[model samples]
Target: MCGIVGAVSQKDIVPILIEGLKRLEYRGYDSCGVAVHQDGQLRRARSTSRVAELQDLAAQDGVAAGTGIAHTRWATHGAPAVHNAHPHFSHGPGVDAPQGPGRVALVHNGIIENHDELRAELKAHGYVFLSQTDTEVIAHLVDLLYQGDLLDAVQQAVARLKGAYAIAVFHRDEPHRVIGAREGSPLVLGVGRDEHAGAFFLASDAMALAGVTDQIVYLEEGDVVDLQLGRYWITARGEVTGRFQSVVREVRTVHAHSGAAELGPYRHYMQKEIFEQPVAIANTLDAVTGISPELFGDGAYRVFKDIDNVLILACGTSYYAGSTAKYWLESIAKIPTSVEIASEYRYRDSVPNPRTLVVTISQSGETADTLAALKHARSLGMLHTMTVCNVSTSAMVRECALSFITRAGAEIGVASTKAFTTQLVGLFLLTLALAQTRGHLTEEQEAEHLKALRHLPVAVQAVLALEPQVIAWSEEFARKENALFLGRGLHYPIALEGALKLKEISYIHAEAYPAGELKHGPLALVTAQMPVVTVAPNDALLEKLKSNMQEVRARGGELFVFADGDTRIESEPGLHVIRMPEHYGALSPILHVVPLQLLAYHTACARGTDVDKPRNLAKSVTVE
Candidate 1:
């Protein structure tokens, strides 16, 4: 994933562009750069480093302009180098200029499928490519098509593109003008208000434009927007005519979390997000007075009643949340549920039933694979669709018939913490709603579940209190290169999430397996050097999980267990136990995952790894 922020404002846009890139850093990037129209010429500075470094470089170069475009790139077509970084330029016919600052400056967020063909065509037209990037091809094409108007050139350039892209382009000749277009990627137009009324902005997310603007226009598929100092215009592609026409898009007021992105007391965003879970869960469930289908959407009751089975589709941590919900839906709602990875589901053949409700789970809601899978399921006649998403204005919410918006605030860490737990809260609510519709949830059962839901925030707070103990465990874990996680029943998905967190942040080779499968194969890999972490709840699987713990100990493998209070598992040689304050019954997974997050965070800290921006990972997966 990449981030784009462009602005046409009266003030010095360099600071705005750099600050916007800083806010977008959670999305992940390898290199960053900014291009500005300064004194009748294009001035830019790029670096293969963090956005903070790029900011310093821009300041050192005195790169200031009232109109500019900035980019934080996670490389796809080229290596992570200064030349491959964006705000790529095309010098056009003036290839022999002193520094070749170029005429067109462009920043792109997605991929170009036919860049090879376009690169060949541009080379034939005497356009030289400096950077080895698909984005460079677009810049050349835009410069080649420029016939005096920047907007027209960008529109014509995008018309020839063959894949997903969201681009912000500016021409040096066109002062105070920036043109943006989105096809498959996400783009938003921020209309500045009050003191900043004369400014206009385009960003990959509304978070990038926080404080500067609260009003956002989410560009639809194939929409092009031209931003000027005081005004903006939008044009949408006609489906039948295949031509762009002027259109009016709704500008919705968005209250972005301007302060949440900051790291206050915590060492990293991952640590801050882990500690923020209790508040995040409370905010996500703030509107729940009682469980009802209307908690999802207007026609959720009708959709729940009509569906026979549930099909859950998601990617990464969202998929694991879906996996946990499968147990809840089957046991509580008496509905057969199947969870599928969105990327694989979209490319494979599957039986899609119209009576089966397809539920999509995503934090950003703009996850490209999950969005494509939702459409694929629709193509197979699965009409009933629902989404558990964090962003209310995301494409997934707009595409689904029903949605539960999680109020996880802004998850700045590349490794998700609060967002994963909040998604489980949404999914559990969906399960209760479906159970009510199916006559499985009685009045008494509903009341008890509601009470548990109300106490969840406090339960999570207690779990967070165990961070000191988890930190001690992390010190030992930091020395190991491999880890194994185990769980049974509903907590098995929690184990998977724990392993994922450790691997993602700490760069350890971690694997998760159902405890029952240990004897079959995983036992061979258990040794004194390997750390086996287990989620041992006081449920029916407790005895079986104890037996699996014995299996690990017999193989000389050290065990770290997160056990419930009632479980008599004590801390002894070769075994370490961290007891829970109480047993949460059905909602135990949410509480159990907190310490695992702490373990990963502290372990990454001990190892001196990048806890917030882990290597080769991004917070939001907007591309397939």
Candidate 2:
């Protein structure tokens, strides 16, 4: 996982490149560097720190470059260091190039799974390398086989590439053009007001290009593009080509959808997103009003007419949403639904039939595995593919047959909060649609469900009022080195998600187990020194959960219980009750989840971790 940006501009491009990298920080990086060709020489700065020392160094006076390439690297092939940073360059590979600098420089993203084999081959050809990165191997390989044309040489080298990558390549002779290509990861070209006066910008996320310009053209898999300031040339893998239609029209996403944001008043994006949950939930419900007649109301009762099964594929928080939706789909829609990790789903040989609908959930709509799943299922002739996504114009939305856009605006945090809730809202709507399609719901029952759906935003608002209480609880976890979360029924999945959030950002060893399974195994890990958060809302499993609580208490374990307002969880001894709004049942997970999100957020914030960007995690997993 790495973030890359390159620009060929008439003006000095160092400032623009650094600004782009700062926005793409969510992609997670151990080290970052930026390289610009200044005064006919390639100059760069890099470091490993939260301070972005590389950008600071490059921003000083006398640093002037018209063309540059920048990278925020997540270490995979080498230790984080100045030497191993990107813009990997090579000249002494084999025979010198017929043209250019006898060397090539490139910034890459994604793992070249066969890099070891490729390196060994090049080494035998007398190509020596300086860095341990797989990317370094590419630079040498390209140079070893270099011909007169740089674009052809790049395509030749890429033909040997085995895994995912998005790269920005430049040569000393071809100083004005930055050639880019992608097989799985993301790359875009940002054009400015005066065409050639603009820059060729490439990044893993659109946010990287947001400040400089709002216009962009995204690259498709197998598409190679050659760019100068104002012009872009598209080509196929082997032959020169161009897209039949431009990325969009002259209008700014005129025929597209987008999320609005208010970044003016928050200390951190996570805090702002947490406060936006209510509106986000409402936005998801509002979208249902425009659902196809065949998918909503009485007219939409035939698509699931004979459907008997469902599959949900997602990653990270979206996968947890799938887990919660499974509970609802089985109970409300009476459909046998299976929740799957997107990476595992495609690798398996199992295929869905025409009667089965596949749902993909993602916040950015660019998750690599989830997109693969959608492709794999559709390739097997399952045209019934739908996506619940936050970004309206993401690749997933464009690829899926049906789409549900989540209302959660800009979720800058690596650990999702509002996106999780909004996805659940979309999933619930899909479940109700399935029920209507299967003829399992009468008009009155549908109305009742609609009313319940309308109440969710209010419920979420009520949940938000508990932030002060959740903040108080953060103290116990701020210094915690390990934690355990337990729940049963629908809330069991929420427990897993809560633990995952803590682990992802806080680097705590957190585990989640079904309350009933505590005695079977996890109980052994429980101790007075460990914090065990139990989700014990007054649902059907409340009494059974109480039994599990008793066992923990008997084991001298510390407990943090989140329960309904009227529930009888005692605050005596070592127990603490995080009281919920009221007697919540199946929907309690959505409400109960807010506190845990807050807990993890504050814990990471208190620890002074980059709660928004985190480590080794991109907001959008554009590459697998």
Candidate 3:
């Protein structure tokens, strides 16, 4: 995943581009660069460093321009270096075009799958490449096609591309405009004060243009947009067939906050997001004054009535949320449920049911694999599609027939704390809606569920109070190299999430298993050196979970347990237990995960690792 920001303004845009890149840094990138048209030529500065470093480099090089494009690149075709950094340029096809030196400068996101073939063709046409990136080919290709009209040349050049990409192109010959195109990738346009009197902006996400401008337009797939100093237009294209058609779409305002992502009192975004769960959950449920099918979207009741089963598609943390929802769906709604890792689901052949309600869960909602999987499911005639996502303008929300927008704000942490919890909140609502529609939920059951939902924020706050205890446990955890987490019944997915949080932030090798699965070979790895963390909720499976804990204890394994107060698990010499003040029953996973998040946060702090922006991790997985 990479981030792109471009602007055409009358004012110097170097600082604006740098600030935009800093905001989009959570998208994850190895190097940063910026290119601007100034002094009748193109000026650029690139760095194999953070955006701040790139800012300093640009300032040192005295590079400033009013109209420019910036990029924060996550290496795809080549290793991370100055040469591979974006804002790549191309002169043209011939020696005379090379003398121009700044015929084209472009910043691109996503992989060009057919770049190798295009590279060979361009090389044969006397085009020389300066970077080992698939993106550089676009610069040359656009340059070769440029005959004066930048937007038309860009449209023609992108017509030859395959795979996902969101790019902003700048041509020295047409310095007044910035051309942006997206196919299977995310792109947005920002409208300034006026259509013809102010600057126009283009970025991969609204976050990049948040403080700069709140009026945002999300570009659909195969849409090429033009951003001029005071005017902009969009041309929507179709890649389904070989022929391309262009149509203009409307501009929509994005309700986003540039300040919400600030760490404020917290040291890291993970911690801030962890503490924000109470607020996030409340916001996610705020629209549900009383649960109904409309809470998801209009006509959701129709989709629920027609569906006989549920198929959830997601990846990583979102997948775990879906996995947790499977228990709620089958038990409450009486609907058979299946959860699939989106990446694996698309590649494998499986039985398809037209009556299956396909639900996709994602934080960013632009996850490439999950989006592809949704399309794959659609192609199989499963038309009932719904998404539980935080970002409202994301492709998942736009492409789905229905959607529930989670108000998790902005999750800047790469490990994902609040987003996961908020997703569970949305999924629980969906479960209740389906159950109510099927008459599976009685009046009393509905009222009780509503009360529990209303009290979830308070329950999560109570769990956050146990942070000091969890932090104490984390001190010992930081000394370990491997970990195993255990949970029973509905909480098994929570155990998996705990293990994921540990490994993702602390870099410790961790694994999770259903408590009953200990006899199936995971127990063999349980030694004194390996710490076993167990989720002991006061549910029907508490007795069985105790038995599993006993198995681990018998193996001389150190045990760290997060147990409900009524679980009857006392702390002993070899057995460590952090008691949950209350038993949250069906919604226990939302409460149980808070301490695990604190554990991961403190453990990462103890290990001096980057808790918020972990190594080799991006907050948004825009690519497969």
Candidate 4:
């Protein structure tokens, strides 16, 4: 995953490129670079440092070009170094000769799967490469194919390439234009006008162009775009191979203010988002006086009635949310449901049902694997697609037939907090809506569920008050090397998420199992040295979960339990218990997860780990 931003305007665009890169740093932050066309040549600055450092380097280098492209790279092909940073350059055919300046600068996101083959071919042509990045091959390929038109050269070069990419390239000779293309990765155009003249920008996401422009045009797959001062055109693959046709598309305005990455009065974004659960849940259900299929989108009722089953595709934290919803969709809605890891779902030779509703979950809504899985499902004749996402302008929302936007604003933490919980809220609402459509939910049942949903904010607030208790447990957990989490029924997925958080941020080895499966194998791993965390929600499976806890205690394993108020589990010797304020039925996972998040956050603090931006992780998986 990487970030790409390009600009073409009458004014100097170096600042715009740098600012946009700052907003996009969450997508990638391994290294950064910017290249601007100046003095009839390409002037560039690259650093194996943060965007702030790159900005300083650019200023020191005085890279004042009217047109430019910038990149924040997450190393995919090589180690993170200055040479591996983006804004890769390619000199013209006269690179070996002393001639006029002819150079091209390019920045790319996604992988070039066939770069080794292309690089060997380019090396035979006497091209010299300075970096070990696949992106460098693209610059040389475009340079060799340049026949006067930059857009045409990019189109031809990309056609011969393989694998996913969203790239932007600009030549020193053609300083007024930037050529961009997308195959499997995301790229968008921001259309704007200033006092002096019109401007156009290209970025991997809209957050990069927050205050720059609100109007955006999402480039489609296999699309090439030409961006010049005031105008841009998208070219799609035509009827025949290698043939292209230009088409016009509508520019949609988005709420740019909603995606602002502001950390207001909080030590870390994860903490801020954890505490914002109340507001995030309230805002996600805002204006929802009652739950109905129409709450998703227009004509959602028709799709709900027609679908016979549900198929959920997601990855990482989103996948756990889907698994948790599977319990709800089947038990409450009486609908058969299957949750599949997005990356693996498409590769398998499974049967696709047209009557099955495909539901995708993502926070950024730009997750590459999930998006590909959704497209694969659609191609297999499943047209009833829906998404639970945070960003309204994301491609997942645009591609789906119906969508429910989660009001979790700007989750900048690498380890997701609010986004995951809000997605659960949205998925739960979908389950109730489907149940009502299927006549499984009576009017009284609907009112009861709605009442619980309305009180969710208060429930979450109460759970957050247990942060001090979680912090106390974190001190002991910080010294532990291994942990095992246990839960049952709907809370099983919650146990998995808790384990994931602990390993993701604190770097503690952790595993989770449905409490019933502990005796099969995990019981052997329990010992005095290993701490066992249990999600003891006071539900139908509470007694069974308690038996699992006893199994752990029999092995001399210390127990840390977040149990509901009604649960009679007491804190005693070798048994640590923190009582949850209450057990909010059917929505207990949302409340139970808050303590787990705080535990991970505080344990990471105790262990001196970077909680907000975990090591070797990216916030959004935009590249597969």
Q: Which of the numbered candidates is closest to the native, going by highest TM-score?
A: 1
- What TM-score, over all chains together, does every model reach? 0.98, 0.91, 0.97, 0.97
Clashing pairs in 2: 27-618, 195-230, 294-300
Q: Model 4, poorest ten-residue lDDT window?
A: 93-102
Is candidate 1 or 2 superior in lDDT? 1
The CA lDDT at 408 in model 4 is 84
Each prediction's number of clashing residue pairs: 0, 3, 0, 0
TM-score of 1: 0.98
lDDT of 4 by residue, 1-624 (tens): 589999988888899999988888766468999988898888889998788998899999898877899998887888999988988888754463312333888999888999999999988887888889999999999999998899989989999989889999998778789999998888998898554248899999888888888888989888899988877899988867658889787798865663447878888778888999999999998878897999899999999999999999999999999999999999999999999999999899999999999999999888989999999999999999999999998889989999999998888888888999999999999999999999999999999999999999999999999888889999999999999998899999999999999999999999999999999998999889999999998898888888988889889989999999899999999999999999888999999988999999999999999787677788888778
Residue-level lDDT of model 2, residues 321-438, one tens digit each, is 9999999999988899999999988888885687777889999888888988888888887776778898776778878767778877777677899999988877877877786666
RMSD of each: 1.4, 3.7, 1.8, 1.9
| Regions of candidate 1 where Cα sits further than 4 Å from its true position | 93-99
Each prediction's Cα lDDT score?
Answer: 0.93, 0.77, 0.90, 0.90
Which residue pairs show backbone clashes in model 3?
Answer: none
Model 4: residue 348 alpha-carbon error in angstroms: 1.0
| RMSD (CA, angstroms), candidate 1 | 1.4
Query: How do the residues 543-584 of candidate 3 rate in per-residue lDDT, one tens digit apiece?
Result: 988999999999999899999999889999779999998998
TM accuracy, model 4: 0.97
- In candidate 4, position 246 carries an lDDT of 94
